[model samples]
Target: MPAPSPLRAALLAARANLAPGLVLQGFAAAIVAGYYLAPPVRTALERLAVFRGEVGLPFAVVSTGIFGAVIPFVILRLSAATRNRYTLAQMSALVAFWAYKGVEISLFYALQARVFGEEQTVFTIVAKTLVDQFVYGPTLAAPLTWLVYAWVELRFDTRALIADLRAPGLYRERIFPLLVTSWSVWLPTVVIIYLLPTALQLPLQNIVCCFFTLLIIFMTRRPTGAV
Candidate 1:
């Protein structure tokens, strides 16, 4: 049999790259459940780890265990689907999501300070913003991160970055896959947020979360003229 055309190979590689994003999206979903469902848990986290308060260490342990238990399985699933070895790809995907979350978190904190005054810290404000901005923001962000990397790979392969930006949309022919790819990661995340205790069910807040996640993705890939 004849070898696959270079175009076919390149497209396959692009699709493979999206796997990392998908995996990280699942991780982002789980984190939303962990940090948001329990108020005391979030407070304990702020006190012990990121900032200092009177929260106990065991709360951290329990919370981490409760939410983090799913991580291994998620990693396993994503790894099984991808061409890249599981560990490296999972790490890379997570790292991408983390970086994306960092930006959104910083924005959230800044806004929190503005609206609530600096006197109030994030733990004190038990609103929907906590999970939407910090947790789920990274769902879309992870995919955007991988897409940027994929774009870079195209550049290295001597394809114009501008040209490759159009590639994601070229598969408009495959709308279901694109929709499936995006929502498969997003809808489960929203569901987890809804099902867990202390879920922020405000309509406006949910809308904003949806908007921001898409906005982040757009900004990341828009420069390249891709969706």
Candidate 2:
């Protein structure tokens, strides 16, 4: 068989790392959103499985399963080369990280509720608003976080990532081409996550929170070529 193109290999590795983390982060956001919705998707999942009564596991599982499947499918559809060297071991590690987040989020909310009681009153609302301005501000920064992570990852693994950037004949390696190829799919999805509230008449805060969780994935992932 012909050897796998270096660009293809690099991109696949990047995607594989990003994909699972994104799904997990997305799942965390979903749990927060489900809190406001009538359905309570998170609690439902907790009730059904090992995650029973757990805070974020249910939502995490649902979000990860759905987005995890969809993003990879979209990537495969867009680039046949994405289906390269994506090992099961890597996928398992991704899922494990996701589960850790689920547990963490659950513990946090649980602790807050137990210590402070439910946050449905006016005073609590005001306090949360104040916290939002400082302590929780990073949670609102999703787009910037993802972009920075992608850039850093690319730089760290520049050699491995763009090994094929130079062909025997081609002299210049245009970064824009590589970026556009990857972001063509990711950018739209990011935009859609933010836009869902406005388009679907859902709560904007929830959408924002969901995107924030997605951002965390990008922030926390172990950069392959940590520059």
Give the best candidate by TM-score. Answer: 2
Candidate 2 structure lDDT: 0.40
Model 1: lowest-lDDT 10 consecutive positions: 196-205
Candidate 1 off by > 4 Å? 1-43, 46-101, 105-143, 152-155, 158-160, 166-168, 171-179, 191-227
lDDT, residue 117, candidate 1:
46
Model 1, 73-116: lDDT tens per residue? 24344654422323444344434443444445345544544554
Clash number for candidate 1 = 0
- Report lDDT (Cα) of residue 227, candidate 2: 31
How far off is residue 45 in model 2, in Å?
Answer: 10
lDDT of 2 by residue, 175-206 (tens): 32233233423343333333222112112223
